[model samples]
Target: MNDGTTTLPWLVIREDDNGNRYRVGRFATRAEAQRTADSLGDHEHQQLYCVERLGARKPGPEQNGTAR
Candidate 1:
């Protein structure tokens, strides 16, 4: 949290010939939300964010919705 004296950490994006990357906003409570939002990756980031992983399913139909 900011105490009216310290600067807040912001989310920023880095772009390269490969693609864009997004960094999530920081822990400061008083920070401006817009500043972080602006740093998020744009459309060019889509391909960069792709990953290979297994899909998990959650229980349903009266069962707890925990992942299986």
Candidate 2:
């Protein structure tokens, strides 16, 4: 069974000089995510911004139509 809900697979991540990472945002498309990362990276040289795709996840109860 498929739920109507969709997940944003593209992630915009930020890594600081200390090597700590933070999730900036999620997007439906890679282009949107990358564009945001590039703009943010241009402003902050010390922090690295990049786009990554989330790994596939198994459908949970909600997605399986088990939960209300």
Candidate 3:
């Protein structure tokens, strides 16, 4: 059964000057993720930090729907 509950969807992303992107962390709230991004950004001026909301996850084959 689909419980309608999702994992942490807020993402803190770090992008380097060379355009390499990395996932810093995931949070349940945007504020929490942003705070972490801000802290990291403050210490690393050469890197860009940002927060993004992940799209709702689709159900997999193990669940009720077919996997994409």
Which model scores highest in TM-score? 2
Candidate with better TM-score, 1 vs 2? 2
- Measured over all alpha carbons after superposition, the RMSD of each candidate to the real structure, in angstroms, is 12.1, 12.1, 11.4
In model 3, pairs of residues that clash are: none
Cα error of candidate 3 at position 42, Å: 1.0
- Write model 1 residue lDDT over 1-68, tens digit each, in one string: 35767544432223345655444344343234333343343344432211111132322435321111
TM-score for every candidate vs. truth?
Answer: 0.21, 0.72, 0.69
**What overall lDDT, based on C-alpha atoms, would model 2 receive against the true structure?**
0.68
Per-residue lDDT over 1-68 for candidate 3, one digit per residue giving the tens place of the 0 to 100 score: 15887679888777687879788899998888877877786663677777777874533435321101
Which candidate do you rate higher for TM-score, 1 or 3? 3
Which residue pairs in candidate 2 have backbone atoms (N, alpha carbon, C) closer than 3 angstroms, thus clashing? none
Q: How far is candidate 3 from the true structure (C-alpha RMSD, Å)?
A: 11.4
